[model samples]
Target chain A: MKWTKRQRQPKLKEHIKEDPFVTDEALAALFEVSVQTIRLDRLEMNIPEVRERIKDVAQKQYDPVKALPEEEIIGEIVDLELDKYAISIMDIKKEHVFSRNSIARGHHIFAQANSLAVAVINDQLALTAHADISFKRQVSEGERVIAKAKVLEIGTLRTKVKIESFVEQSLVFEGMFSMFREEKKIKEE
Target chain B: MKWTKRQRQPKLKEHIKEDPFVTDEALAALFEVSVQTIRLDRLEMNIPEVRERIKDVAQKQYDPVKALPEEEIIGEIVDLELDKYAISIMDIKKEHVFSRNSIARGHHIFAQANSLAVAVINDQLALTAHADISFKRQVSEGERVIAKAKVLEIGTLRTKVKIESFVEQSLVFEGMFSMFREEKKIKEE
Candidate 1:
């Protein structure tokens, strides 16, 4: 996405609009300009620096766990140690449950756990190869669901992560995820 | 579309997939039949009740702003003070705007306001009691809509808040929300 300065500042804003975690250095490289020029352009345009942009995105209500801002992470990560462990919390509102039963849907619990497992990987480019998940118990609205993820093993091209979710210390869901982390070019070799 | 019970069966399936929020009463009225007749018609067609249909739809999509559990909320909140005030910002995307007109959907604005009103309540058990809302102007995708909410009054069981949304300096939406809060209590004893 190369752009002349005349065209780049606004385009720079749009790129960040789509992914606020993008660094100025990456923007500079993409625009084929010096990093300082990207910084200056962002400053002139009143866009915050990358870190601040991420923080601003984080501070929003229902702001999600955003390791990959484009990935649909359904919860908020309060703690993460890349590829080692991560934890997130999702509060179930009335909308999260079946109106007739008031029981939270199973997939929401899976999404929270699966998303955390994927988000905890160290690689910049990673994808979920497959996930094994179980719904141990029904969760209800007004409950804060906490999901914890631990990287069990890291292979050359695959990483293993386990996620467990609890509400008030009782297990409600569990998932094991195998993630793909190798680059496509490297895999071709 | 006009249809007898036999003709409505398959069409009912399609309508609920598109708008699961449609109630039995509404469907009955639309189909010019008694509510019980609608129930029998639904049973004959093997369609679940409205609540189940909604849950099914929610599980398959990136649904949020979840009044109906089929629409997505596009913002993050920078500030919130339960039962008093709140602030959030939504970056409109291509999907948020109409392709032909480039105007964001009216329901998205309403969702942002209604959800904020419910979210800002101090109680763990709160819902949108009612909302009196209006769109002040059409907003385009790529615009950041900043919504600020203020509590107008607080009653024993209900709180009233006003929300005004803006893109730049222009007002795009205004809403007065009445929210309900209560204890599950006559039983917490």
Candidate 2:
């Protein structure tokens, strides 16, 4: 619905707060306003552009988490449920492997899997006690590795986590991880 | 030996080329000149600051080796020899690990190893066929991981590489990588 500028300005601020990465162009279409109007509204609200907003969030929100710091997770956590399941995505880059092979080095795949595994643990301190891991297939450079980690068992001092990393539908790596949870508090989500 | 203004200018240029990360203070100390003079010399030579030089080099030298670009390698390549050995150093930061644990994400440590492994391969097409890997200890954030990769065996189509990652001489992770050399060229070293 086409809303008045007075009404649209307030809505714009709220939308940006909800998703900082929301584009001005998209907001223009959503609010039925010109791009200039949206930019003006953002300037009036003292809100930076989408790129700056992301950088601001990265700097501010990359704080300590329940299990670890936000930034140290191999890939950004797109979804999470503590002690249950978690997912992360990493864009394989040229730096991730040998220039000759163009395939992602094994550990890059492992990093994505391992971090997602640790993040799913509900604790302040989660350390890898042991892991039975293997590379199932070769992952090429530039392929995105989507790692999904599931909690298999939650014991007194240890948790069994299973991680399977894939490029699209193809599985690249899998691991059965034993995580040691130190100082576990009885918290439920 | 201390060099004068006339002699120092050329040497300063050479030093920056050798190590773009060289500090202005270090250059000043080496040439027995003020920091301002170093800046002036840099300005006169049309060279940017250390940070800018690094960015420039990253942009230029990070060529697509095979699958990934050179710049994406986790740490600076302090030393390298194709199909032989490679050494890299990574400074752990809050950005690289879980905040609460302060331990680096496994992949980061793995990245240091994997990148070094790829780097040590002589072929222009080096791919990790398989890796038997293990983590020996937890590496906390703010520690440096020195990854050293050595070629265990070089075959006609594959090279067996061994990567050991350490923090202050204490082993953290070890892996035996079987890298596939898809196309081997008889290039002189």
Q: Going through the candidates in order, state the TM-score of chain A alone for each one.
A: 0.61, 0.63
Please write out the lDDT profile of model 1 over residues B1-119, one tens digit for every residue: 66776787877778776766567877787778789988998898888986566456535642133222213233555566655677666778887554545767554665566556655
Instruction: Give the residue spans of candidate 2 off by over 4 A.
Output: A1-66, A69-81, A89-108, A129-132, A138-144, A153-158, A184-189, B1-70, B155-158, B184-189
Candidate 2 per-residue C-alpha lDDT over B1-189 given as tens digits, one digit per residue, 9 for 90 to 100: 777767888888988888666667677877788899999999988989865675665565433334245676778766666666776778788877755556676777777777777777655556566666777898887676778888889876567889888776578988888776656534321
- Which residue pairs collide, candidate 1? A60-B76, A60-B77, A61-B77, B83-B120
Residue A136's C-alpha lDDT in candidate 1? 65
Give the per-residue lDDT of model 1 (tens digit) for A61-131: 32233245433456877667787888777879887775645867554566577668767876544555555
- Model 2 CAPRI quality: incorrect
Backbone clashes in candidate 2 total 20
Instruction: List DockQ for all candidates.
Output: 0.02, 0.22
Model 2: what TM-score?
0.55
Question: Candidate 2, B7: how far from true, in Å?
Answer: 37
Candidate 2: C-alpha RMSD after superposition:
14.4
Model 2 DockQ, alpha carbons vs. true complex: 0.22
lDDT of 2 by residue, A1-189 (tens): 788878888888998898765667778878888989899988988999865775676555332336776676777776677888876678788876645557666777777787777788777778776676777778777676778888999877569899988775668888888787776434431
The positional error of residue B48 in candidate 2, measured at the CA in angstroms, is: 24
